[model samples]
Target: MADRITLTGLRVFGRHGVFEHEKRDGQEFIVDITAFLDLTPAATSDDLTKTLHYGELAELAAGIVAGEPYDLIESVAGKIADEVFAKDARLTEIEVTVHKPSAPIPLTFDDVAVTVHRVR
Candidate 1:
């Protein structure tokens, strides 16, 4: 298995939902990304170029989450995975998790999330 670079609990605000109020008012969204790649090159060479820059990855994921609107968190997670593939050719796999805490559910809950995995 490849080594992993994981970024967790990135919070952002977006207007994404099936309901009109949710779309208009917006809500907070949390994102987590686990990117799999060979860390041997970076570890051996001690160079930043040998691996993906996690800060940039987080910014990209945050931009995707805060920029556009999607009815489903699954779609959000998939798009994030696609972005990771587009940006990093070295990554072998990626796991994206989108969390919605302010979802308009009438009942009580801790949180709601969707996770998507992609491999290259």
Candidate 2:
């Protein structure tokens, strides 16, 4: 499917990092999701039941980010992908991006992010 549904810059506080202070203090995490599906059903039927609900997807991402403490953003993104696949069977493809603005890096940078793309 060429149609895409995208959610960007979703902020959630999470204790996910390699350092102890990072896990204890916690930091903000930004998530972006792009899900691919056939929009024809929703377009023709004019019913939300025919399409993926974005609000539920956001909650799933937030729940994962706020629930567990992972040492890597890769793991976080992977979990998000797993949730997306589990939540809806109609989704043909999904891309999840986890952004860490307050990483424990000594050097200055704009942001650090991990993006995972999955296809069913």
Q: What lDDT tens digits, residue by residue, belong to model 1 across residues 2-109?
A: 599999999999888889888889999999999999999999999999989998998999898888888888988999999889988888999999999988899999
Q: Between which residue pairs do clashes occur in model 2?
A: none
Cα displacement (Å) at residue 25, model 2: 0.6
Candidate 2: C-alpha lDDT? 0.95
The collision pairs in model 1 are none
lDDT of 2 by residue, 13-51 (tens): 999999999899999999999999999999999999998
lDDT of 1: 0.91
Cα lDDT listed for each candidate: 0.91, 0.95
Clashes of each: 0, 0
Ten consecutive residues with minimal summed lDDT in candidate 1? 14-23
The TM-scores, one per candidate, come to 0.96, 0.98
TM-score computed on alpha carbons, candidate 2 = 0.98
